[model samples]
Target: MRLMIVAALTLVCVAPAVAQDFTAAPNYGDVRLAPGFSPDPHLVVVQAGGSIDVDGTLSNCSGFITSAPDLRLFWDGNGSLDLKVSAISNADTTLVISGPNGAWYCDDDGGDGSNPSVTLSSVSGQYDIWVGTFDDGETRSAVLSISELSSF
Candidate 1:
């Protein structure tokens, strides 16, 4: 009887450790722009009829420098959406949207380079977007905004 109790307690203690919560922020990595990329990589999961707000800065220079149009957002899925940023130099930033099947419903490539927004009518699961870098020989950075109306 004592052995059974100890085993149960051991399982209870270790179970939670194996189940990690990615939404806690620390689990997510920095949104970094690849070589010649702008905004970098940003990913999240949202439910149907949900929406996400995105606002950030980008540039060839290091650190958070907001000049105007620095990063761009692109969506490759049907139910997905994006808020893209552009500069006077017309820097190229590729934001690819991809996720699991069936869950990939809607999307939007947020353009205008200013402040952009997107609403998901019906979609779920994990989605990813890669921010490209401008060809100014400077590094680019971007801040991500996300919201989930449904269960993660």
Candidate 2:
């Protein structure tokens, strides 16, 4: 009888802990720009299972415009993703991508931001996108856009 009572007490103590399962949503956003010819870009944030449409120009990328624009996204680190952009004369523009785990990728002197899709290769979390000129005192511009996919 004492063993039965102890078993009941143990189950009652452990039930609440097991019932408290939790999952976290990731964060997203863009970084600020330093003083340069390129105007300060902007960003919009969406929910964990949300989508965002981006349209803007990386204009006048001359005179100390050595850094790329920042486009960031946040999620639960598990989903499908798509990043789309179109460009005009991308000869002077560059593409920079920042991913989870401190991964960085870039495209040098491309035709505007005219590109296909940038999909997440591994588990998804928060990723940053950016663009800029080569800082050679030559003006450049490009249009950017995005399309996101996920299952929450």
Candidate 3:
């Protein structure tokens, strides 16, 4: 039970940022890290069987932005995941993704506050990503959009 508790605690980005409804993209579901999973920060294998989408709104996420305890994402397929912020609101956001053949991305209000996009290209593995407020603990609507480009 303790191991299950730990694993559950590890994968979720909780105490979110807003109060609106969230419609996650297709292939979306709760993802968990299984036992005996690789300690490799390079690959996050899925456990049980569910997939989190590339795009969705995170609501009421309460916390300050910090470099540690970021979320992990695994592409596991060839193509790029264009991770962007706020296709739905005017929340100022910062997105950082690292991994996959030296594809390290970080963006802060690159679009307009209107938006910003950080794309990870040539992906075929896991990645670690985080969404942060331009200011800490700013409870507002933050939308994350993930698009699969050149999917083959």
Candidate 4:
């Protein structure tokens, strides 16, 4: 009984260290978009980085982000074209997205310069996105762009 109690306490203490909850409300607002929506590249200004560390939390996910998502995107369209989600900033940035299929995708330096971009082959549902800095505890201004044609 003592061993079981200790084990349960251990699990509770360590759980938050590796958790990144995408179900929380976004820090920025949410956006709904369909394929070929006018204003091809939807953009939003965001502050990248947060208190939550993402290293080793999920496969290919890095950098630090808030407990809630920076942006939640509702994609109402077919998978004819790929969806491109990216961040543009002077500071080195990273991208973490939770797709509707419950898959987590991440990217670092996949865009121009030190920015990050993730192109989703499957594109049709809610995507909780987080823009983060490569370094810990560093928050910077960035532009989050969603497009099917190109990445920023």
lDDT of 3: 0.40
Listed in order, each prediction's TM-score against the native is 0.28, 0.39, 0.44, 0.91
Please give the distance, in angstroms, between residue 49's alpha carbon in candidate 1 and its true position after superposition: 30
- Over 1-152, each residue of candidate 2 has an lDDT whose tens digit, in order, gives 99999999998876622110012222333433222212322223321111111112122211122233335544332433333322223434444455666665554433324332234454455556554444344544544434332111
User: Per-residue lDDT of 49-74 in model 1, one digit per residue for the tens?
Assistant: 10111122211111111122122222
When 1 and 4 are scored with lDDT, the better candidate is 4
Alpha-carbon lDDT, every model = 0.29, 0.37, 0.40, 0.88
* Top-down TM-score ranking: 4, 3, 2, 1
Candidate whose TM-score is highest: 4
Instruction: Tell me the lDDT of candidate 2.
Output: 0.37
- The true-versus-predicted C-alpha distance at residue 104 of model 2, in Å, is 0.7
Off by over 4 Å in 3: 1-70, 79-88, 149-152
TM-score of 2: 0.39
Worst 10 residues of 1 by lDDT: 46-55
Error of 1 at 143 (Å): 1.5
Model 1: runs farther than 4 Å from truth?
1-92, 102-109, 114-121, 134-138, 147-152
Of candidates 4 and 2, the better by lDDT: 4
Best by lDDT: 4
Put down candidate 4 lDDT per residue, 1-152, tens digits, no spaces.
Answer: 99999999999877746456777879998999888887989999999998877986787788988888999999987756898999999988999998988888999999999999999975678999999988877799999999989998
Please give, for residues 88-136, the per-residue lDDT of candidate 3 as tens digits.
2455555545565655455655555434456554455555555455544
